[model samples]
Target: MTARHVLLLTAAAYASDPDGPWVDGGLVLRAAARAGLGPSALDAAERAGLERSPDGRLRLPGRRAVYEAAHPARRRAAHRLLAEAALGERLRPAGLLHRALAAPYPDSALGTELAAAARLPGPSHGERATALAHAAGLAADPEVRAGRFVAAADQARLAGRPHRARELLGRIDELTPTDAVRGAAALVRGLLALRDGPMADARASLLLAARLCPGERALDARLAAAEAAWALGDALAYQEAVAGQLSGAATARAFGLGMAAALDDRYAAGRVTLRRVVADAAGAGAPDALLRAGAAALVAGDVEAACRLGSRALAAARALDARPELPRALELLAYGELRAGRHARARTHAEEGLRAARAAGQRNVLAHQHAILALVASLDSDADTVARHAAAAQDIAARHGLVQAATLAQWALARADLARGRAAEAAARLGPLVRPGPRQGHFAVRMLAVPCFVEAAVSAGDLGAARAAVAEFNVWADRGYDPQAGALLARCQALLSAGDPVRADARFTEALARHERAGGDFERARTAELHGEWLRRARRPARARVLLRDALVAFERCGASVWAVRTAAELRATGDAPSHPEAPGRLSELTPQQLRIAHCVADGATNREVASRLSVSPRTVDHHLRNVFAQLGVRSRVELARLVDRAEATRAL
Candidate 1:
């Protein structure tokens, strides 16, 4: 029946029996959210005191106060108020009329209200399935028992636990074989196949189920399977499969089908499908569909829509005490917050999700949580924490046969090493990840490999290989895949190798900008340290000293002992080091920027040429030479060049 009709029936039942099932409000709210209704509507309903109980029933306050005091005619008015409030714009009269007839005392005022609402269209098949699933555990009828088992399977699939759902379906088969039971079993098998990493099997199972059920059950599975096939590049199969299922499935099927279309780059078609899915799911109380709708909204870059849908999903998940969906919902919320530059809130949500995943023993979720944590740590420039978490992730991935995750963990480790001045070690560790090979099963893992390869090549001073690696990275970046800070560092190193010192300096500045935007100062400090080195090489010792000193402070704050020590060494040599209260001027300047600049100039340019190149007049170049005469710097430009070159050579050795 229509949502309005259901609400009217629920209201009448409540009026007649104050304790009757009126908990359908939650389900209605869920459906409305899926249908793309504004959060304001749901909030209004909540404020109006429509809360769903844990048992999936509506809990209205002071049930006897309104119904008992009202006449039969007034009772109908109450039912209308409840129905209008619950269904909102989604209500129609046809479904309401049907609900009226189904209620007790069909000729009563309550029944009349239901009859009027019954004229409206009812929830789509997918919504019906969702509602059935939500109320299944409380249902006692044999048909409902079977349907509940199926709904259980659907829940399992949505939570990424297809294996458990499959097992449950197997048990359901032992009970009886109704159309719903058989259809749900087939759909469950298809979902299981999809989860098992076999799109072909999933498609076949779903296609067969589509012919058998020809309702929401088969339609949902078929569309999901089609999308899987499309993702695997079987476009023709996807089209044929979708075409066959489209004529029978509910509008919500379009959402799943649209997801497939989007994967195939049919953006327009995907948009059309998702819109319908949202509408239909909103009409039928389906939290899973609402979550999908929210995700789609996010993909479309509709921040408002995403927040509305996500809020609804979160509410439903909370109402149901479904802890599994909680993390997924929280992740979406965190993503939104992160986009808005609310890093503190984002981190809070991310940590909450991690805790939930750990409590539930969900390894896949745990892996994702750790990856996010690594990103946070990278932003914070807490190299030790990043390394520890990344290693843990790799260990978990290896144990779970997740090759792509292992690769990412290795990349994270390489980044940690690079930050600690262990470039050679980082190069060795990241070398194997960048080699040409067949596509890894995980998309994230494969994408990660490109940056790791670039970093290693640049670190090892293999400019040719780095250039080649960057060509691949540029492709992914062009496709809208922006790598994280660690990857950006690799890009900066390549720019430095290309000798565009200015652009390289700009890239370092950009990295720091991003780090600060991500709500952490650690990466900014590290970038500043690198920028100082670049500046020092460019003959800007004054500015370099300030940057290096700041970096040293950051390193010490983050407990980065290796980096702190190295920065201190650079500080002393620059003659800009902070004075020790106990031993002032105890540190000696080992090398100076002017000396390096002189070496670079004399190695290739004449005195007049060096003066022009360094933006100094010829007279100043001669004056510096006179000072050079007094200092062990020597008399002639050639001798000065020799001394500076020898010092550089010794340092390199």
Candidate 2:
């Protein structure tokens, strides 16, 4: 056989697989043999018009022209021959493609195989997706086409193509689909709406999906509806979504029910159920389950457990390509770190979570991340950042009825007001949020904000209001959910008991004692500052100096610059100027990511180890480390370690 015959045969083989840009090299070889051409002619054809990619796939240049030029009979022969060859080679997608093309009309047999392969979870997702798309177009029956399109819509959604997913879902309207197939389509639509906004629509679609789907899928749809209800702060909807579903041992279902309990303020029941979620999810493979369980742990006030679960979820989500869960996992870590009083670490996680939420089109998670960032900025007295993030969060929350995000953003704004010493403004701002009213904040957050409300009220000289707020705060503190709640409650009591010197001193002393057992340095510092102020007013300058100085140092160490400044001024008022005021340290100048990398490297973690621990690429670790070194003016890891040691020693003082 001449090289001319090889080119013609290879072009016909390429034409047989016209949907793909190129044909498999093995297909070309099979076609050549069927054409009575020796294997040696293939090399000559390669030197002719046939081209080979670096990946070893075969293509014929001007293949479209070659295909159009070919006789109809020859193309049919090539399709039959190529289909048989693909089957023999066990190329399922290729054989299905060729066999479907060889049919005169839509082929149901080929479409079934293609649809099954496309829906199967595997590494070759793109190939499966392409084959199924072709199969759906050529399917003979309307129901079969609708079913295939349903799977295709799911594949598009999972692949992060929202528009294409919606387009595929639209195709279902033109055909008759079984309830199961229609239900599956609804589930995908609900998930997309759940990620992207309008919580009411998401909840409606999810509830519909739950009713229409099979048993297992119904459970999934219900759990997802529970999520939308949680975001909307619709407790009744949350209960309805998870009703009669708490008996199961599945980690996800238990987590959803636990969250429902949290929304109901049943801390004991929620914590007990969430403990099971934590245990079960530790061994569960689904990243979404781990994320849901982590969220339950967060709501149960188990900050350390939540952080641990969030880390595992983040790593697993990335490994499993679960992009939608990535932001939620990061949110758990950020909020946990914030509660743990690691402001810089919280900032780092919040910053990354915000980006992930935006990329994944999770508007509600995006708003929540913004609120986290806003709170972080409020701590540092960065009013612009606080306002910017809070506004961004509130705007989205208003449009989508995101109650949690709105509550968090408002709390951040009020915290900024209190930090800046606008006590009256802060008190007014927090009144509706903490009290029972039409504009009241979320239940859990409203309770958490009570301490701040009490402080603001006391500072504004509204002792009656402060006392009433403390009475409510006392109830939450007695529950023992938040470790810092007890300490904060004592401080509030001291603020209200200033008229009785002995009672005021006792409450202040109790607050300081409780602070030792709590985790947040910021809260501890607030108590110390308040106690010092009381002592100074009571003509005890020496004791006032000690507490004030301690509060000042703690504030600076935790990056609460405004609080540090206020504490320093209080110390100075006692006629004792602070010797170690806020100083710019190498650690303080670095961004959150850079600072974390510096600390890890200084602790003797290699770049790869840091990357693994943070669930980022080693190259990302290396890049951040270089920026850390440049920012800190450090030449080596040894220098960074020395700097970190000095910073720790300074903070310890």
Candidate 3:
């Protein structure tokens, strides 16, 4: 075998002696002998100082820098071996134990051990780490210097300075070079790339690391590469990278699994994984795992848990003062609040999140944050705010290919149009989104917007489109959504039957009941407005009057101007003035239906004649006229005529 192979075998054997000095050259010669090196090679190793001859016998170097720069497992083995020979022994006991036991047993053993112990060096980790650190300063050998650089890079990475870690790792080849050292450099570079981004290039570095690493170091590189694959959204790479991690930190691994599931839109699996990630004392986690967990909770419809986790994540981010992570934490927290119907608080969080994202130059997060703000504005019926933010968000999302954000912005803009009475324009904008497609996996997002889309369709007289939207939504509801989403689904169904007056009334009742079960005041108010409009169109003036008034109150309370104004108009059409609303009993106060009956009586038509013309029974017509006469304080048809004449004469005057 070549000298390098013998030296490698020697290092492996040195690392394998679980009970021996962690890094002893004398033990290495024995280990080389174990690898089949002959006495002559051992002598050569001794003369070459690889098996350092301190006195008459070969021994390991007293310093800890000897094997400290090797691959991770090897470095670990070296440190562990040093630790086993604790207190930084000046001399190794492995060789002496043998030499003493070889002599006259009891008599020579104690003396040999005593001499060995007397010559022992400091073997504590602090002492060895200190010695190894100083040795790097004095290291003139390129390989030795490279090892020291690797050691420093390890510390830098652990300390969270990716830039400094990169700087140290970059010098491996210039200092002490090996394919293994180069692999070590590559692994650190890949990890740094992941933590700080431009994640596109991380895969290449991690691939290089996995390829060049000699042993278990490949496992570390491959696992990190999987995470890089997830960040880049590369499915094939994620599969390969994930397949390599047979074992590791369970929580960290679960976090990775959760992220992969979330990317694939497998919410059930993702939620399960997230639960594992945050279970108090479970697996180890990265700094951002909490935020990821919170996001998963939000998507799974666990709003309360999502909000709690988000708060915790933001607090953790603040504690660390990690500017890059703050925006995502805030964004997640805002989403939770939005789901919980805390609109004002959600707006505040989203605005702050947007500012942080902009300052951090996080374009992806900035796009999502802007979408969030637009959605909040849309809820408040603030058309101007919705238009501005939705436009900005859509532009960035389109450029970045952030399909989710782009679609959400479209939803906000379309809803704004619907609120403003541009139903045709709203339906036109939302048509493509309501249908089933590749984007349909974003069930909740689409589900939330479908009600608005259905409204637009009904108002635009696109019954077919409205029906299709309701059908598509039914599929989602069947698969299951949260109760709030179920409420929205019911609301959409009610809107679909807008032309069928009886069915619309029944469905509107069902929908409002569902909303009450789910508890979103905004949705309840919006549904009320729709039901009132339907009732007014059906000529159920008494029912319409009550619903419209209640709806107006709700809309105003929720700050929904457009719906409030529309409800007011409907109230006026129900024969109640918007401002005064026809208090108790007043002259000339009559429903459209009642006024028609009054005119029929004023024309001197018999009740039978009036019933024939008005498509009602004579008794019904007589009864309506009696009520109209009572309202005007007139007892008979001729008296009603006199009252009508007086109203006409007053207008003429």
Per-residue CA lDDT of candidate 3, range 284-316, in tens?
133366775675566455677778787777877
Every model's TM-score: 0.51, 0.76, 0.56
Q: What lDDT is obtained when candidate 3 is compared to the true structure?
A: 0.62
Which residues of candidate 2, in runs, are more than 4 Å off?
Answer: 1-106, 124-131, 245-249, 578-653
Per-residue CA lDDT of model 1 for 1-653, tens digit only, reads 13333333334434222223344554445544444455575445456655666666666565455335546654454444444445443433322432342334433343334323322344322232333333343344556557666765665555445455665576565567687567767777775654343456667777777767755656676676664554343556666676643654455556556655654557667766665665555654456667777766644444456666767887887776554566667666665554443445656777886777665445544655565565455433335577767877666655544454456566666665664456777767666556454533344244445554565566678777666656656554433322243435444553545478767766776766665644434445656776787777778899889899888777656544445545655654565522422221111122353554455444534345556677877677666655554655354433443344345434454
Arranged by lDDT, best first: 2, 3, 1
How big is the positional error of residue 180 in model 1, measured in Å on the Cα after superposition?
A: 5.3
Between candidates 1 and 2, the TM-score winner: 2
| Best model number under lDDT | 2
lDDT of 1: 0.54
What order do you get sorting by TM-score, best first? 2, 3, 1
Error of 3 at 44 (Å): 68
